[model samples]
Target: MRTKDENMRVLVAEDEEVLAELVATGLRRAGFAVDTVYSGDAALAYLGLHDYDVVVLDRDLPRVHGDEVARRLVADASRTRILMLTASASMEDRVQGLDLGADDYLGKPFEFPELVSRVRALRRRSARPVPPVLERHGLRLDTVRRTAHRDGQELDLSPKEFAVLQILLEADGATVSAEELLERAWDANADPFTGAVRVAMSKLRGKLGEPALIRTVQGVGYAL
Candidate 1:
């Protein structure tokens, strides 16, 4: 149910102005809506306020560090897809970033086309058709319907918003990856920096209220 135009939202968290601008322009030219920030703090604030499809993050960011930002995002129920780009190509660094909950880890000097393709792949995984209704932690979800009721209270939800919640509840209290959410909630032609998933989850949390049923697993995904 996603059109080409409907899937273009990207967030770039790179400290270098030239690199950030280049990425932003390239994304725009590729038929995507893009936002670029110079630091991890700015990126996190932007994520809190806006909805995007994917996030392009730099590993070495100022004002909170890219790794910390990634952690915060994972803690967020929205579970946005993150692509960590680092100048370091060390296998250890790659493994660490993946362990830090980034959906994709690309070393510097990566091909632009590969990044774009990865973005699309992440999107497809999120939006694909999967079992919508699921139960966990005493919550019931009818994902496509966007209606949730835990203990008989009618919990209203928007489409993208509920998708985030579904991912958490269906997690069965296990850590669910951000990349997995991207693939399951959107189309393969999705932008990796889009923050829509995060925005949706924020609204969902507001609707649910109290005790925060969703818990953050540090560098891991959300659990019920």
Candidate 2:
């Protein structure tokens, strides 16, 4: 049985290069796996390749229009939620975007915190919403607060370590492959063979300590 508590994968589909990178960076810092695309066409292609939990789409995109992209996603019945962003703040624009199948709408010059909050809210309404906190094997993880504790002792963890731990806990004892961990915790630019996952797991185990909860399945993956 697969659990829907996997790390939230996000796509930022904005034509503005700076804004796209900024949003992606912000989301990544917030402990989400993010990818960016500067055009609606590119967004569509990425969507076809990966299953993203949310797509922050810009309404005015180069190559293909954002409206068409939303229509296509809706027509295909994708599980990916759409957060439409536009320069227009008019009620008509919001309604039009919603009618076009966007799950939520945000106007330009918006607050970054609000965007993150909106993304979290949208994700919570997915097939199975994960709690803000996760506990397993005497370890506790606070997703929103960005903190971790093991047996009531506070554990200092880096961003990568925290993300890896989160993914493992969300797996709910299921064996999660290294590729899936990299895909869900790191960005698209991360090289698969860089041993990054191995390094992160080592640090995480050190922080987690004692009982050696994380188990490597040799030819498979890691499970807790």
Candidate 3:
């Protein structure tokens, strides 16, 4: 099966807890790392702490207001893309959102698939975008297809393992710290002290097999 996007991090900022959770679940199932907040203040707090690929924001939000959140993010020159959401689908609303620096806008009661499509599109327009397939040495990973192969033999991999591998390949031989891997692959709730990265790396190496391609930089992190 083909996957269209990597584990791009996303934030869902909507006051309606039910809708927010539903959106988060769908995005997570579609292979994106997602976090949710009920207020604009919490949204901004999360934004300050994490480098989200996109924010699925509600225009009419509690506390800080979605417009102010977008304005602040833009003023700070943050690279995170904004996909403004609202109950109103008026032309004026769309234009206002775009004018406020939102990368895209979606009204409420929208289809889940369209939201996924928009998020993927925003990731492509990010500061760094990866190709559908990545190859280094004898290893080949199809990010879009969600498959990995070594010397033409397909390898079985878990979701986390696939995400970690994609991050390493995207690094292009540069040593990626475990912290960076967790931030990109896991949600905000992931504990930094947890050995999640180590566990995932070990399994990934075993699946890759033969001469180990992943290298540890001692005090540093991991590289291809």
Candidate 4:
């Protein structure tokens, strides 16, 4: 199926810089293109600029305040999903956040893994259902089984390679930027200056031999 990072984007709004950065790092490691803002207003501005799959918002935010941000996002009724966070873990607080149109809620002092899982769940809800299998250009991918075949021959691929290929297939011949590939296939900690994407692409191309299926757009990105 589609991984959390496959074309999925996330916005993290937290007043606390350290916590916000930590959360952003974790989500990025989990393979999401994550952006962080320290205030609710910044979050709103970023939301206006880009379409995100999910937003991890802290209730206690400066500037516009988290509650108002959630309200405005709900009113917009954009496809962006929200996961509200707060130190107040009371039943009433949980109900109130949900009432404000938050797709999910988590209290402060939460586990990092749990936050990642919740974000992924919210992203799945916001994204269109992924097809079980994808086939194009002599390549066939079984998303459910996590397998790939070309010209009826099985292709052994690493997790990163598989993820990269899936993104290209989903693009349907559209050029995918190298930055986009790194965001979706690698973690936030990946060194942007490194040749990680290039190496992985080389390996992938080697495996999917014959007539080149992937084409480089020269500074634009790669298209298949």
Candidate 5:
């Protein structure tokens, strides 16, 4: 039974024909949409044509190298999760693989059932709710957790700043005015001349670092 989630597509990049076939077959039986490629170069080419929810990559790949592939994918503007598979079980290898952007690592001689579990994890990660994941250019908000990240680093935000960010995110790129923000984020009864919004915006921009991704609309509120 292919659960609604299990229908997610995956890419398998492995040079060994038998092992790649085995993974593809097992994944298909477990209700995943899978495409298998024999080399790193081929994997990149496949990705150019199809978007996958997850990628099962072999560490020992020809031409492209699994670690490089994972790095490139992570740097790209896509949300594809990668699981690295290999025979080397050394700690250094594992850490290096993770540092290169592999979400999960599986040393070879593993069972099919376990691979299914990791695949599920990868899919979940791809669909994971994020509050600050939405951004235009350099600003992103992790919505689910109410955190912010700029250029891959976390941003420290005050409670009020976070609330203001939420309003902008909910607006979905539409311009929001100060009146609306004051009414929605704070109280209409509060002192508007205190420059509360400006203060918060200043701190937020400082944390985010210029050139600012958020824009001022001249006498209005702000736009993301």
Candidate 6:
């Protein structure tokens, strides 16, 4: 089971660089961790390396083709949802894309807000079921309401901080590596060598306060 915050990762595979950047920027502004690739092959490479909640794929893609990419993803039984994007708006085209394993289809010149909404809806549908509320060590989190409290005291947490806390809590006392945290909390845009995880953990610990709830595994990572 995964939290909504942890499922905010998205991959945008559009051959048009401008459109890809525009979509990625909008998704990021909407609080989604997004990665963009200009080719279907690059999209496949990224998909192989990362766990994304949703993939916004262009139907007409270069190098391997978007339909083939969708087929491979479906054949692999990937949990990641696919949203096919194309200039074609025919009913038959939409049906064909859906039949090819896309969870949803969108015509080009679509509204950015609509894309965001569809992506969010797809992610919610793909996420594994989890308890609405998670509790451990006097810390309680409401996954549905997106709220957290420690010993009955409400904690004002940033989105990233909340995501990190949720991941740590979900680990159930197991150590979560920094790479894993970056994959889950952030997105492919994050630099692998960055200290973003350390900084987020620091803020999370500070918010948790007193009797620290997170423990660092020296060279490994952080644990609850």
Winning model by TM-score: 2
Q: In what order do the candidates fall by TM-score, top score first?
A: 2, 3, 6, 4, 1, 5
> To one decimal, what is the Cα RMSD in angstroms of model 4 from the true structure?
4.8
Name the TM-score of candidate 2.
Answer: 0.95
By lDDT, highest first, what's the ranking?
Answer: 2, 3, 6, 4, 5, 1
Better of 1 and 3 by lDDT: 3
Query: Can you give the TM-score per candidate against the true fold?
Result: 0.55, 0.95, 0.91, 0.73, 0.55, 0.83
Best prediction by lDDT: 2
- Candidate 3 lDDT over 1-224, as tens digits, reads 11223468899999999999999999888778899999999999999988888999999998999999999999999888999999999999999999999999998889999999998898888655688889998889997778999999999988778888888887878888887788789998888888989988999999999899999999889999
Tell me the lDDT of candidate 3. 0.88
Instruction: Estimate candidate 4's alpha-carbon lDDT, on a 0 to 1 scale.
Output: 0.85
Give candidate 1's TM-score: 0.55
lDDT (10s digit) by residue, model 2, range 1-224: 22456667899999999999999999988888899999999999999988788999999999999999999999999988999999999999999999999999999999999999999888887668777899999999998898999999999998778888988898889899898888878877789989989989988888888989999999899999
lDDT of each: 0.72, 0.90, 0.88, 0.85, 0.74, 0.87
Worst 10 residues of 3 by lDDT: 1-10
Better of 2 and 6 by lDDT: 2
RMSD of 2: 1.6
Q: Which runs in model 3 stand beyond 4 Å of their true positions?
A: 1-7
User: Per-residue lDDT of 141-201 in model 5, one digit per residue for the tens?
Assistant: 7643556777778888765676677667656777777766654444223478888778877
Query: Looking at candidate 3, what is the lDDT of residue 4?
Result: 28
TM-score of 3: 0.91
Q: Which one wins by lDDT: 4 or 5?
A: 4
Candidate 1 positional error at 112, Å? 1.1
Model 6, position 205: C-alpha lDDT score: 89
Model 2 Cα displacement at 10 (Å)? 0.8
lDDT of 5 at 155: 80
Model 2 / residue 16 / CA error / Å: 1.1
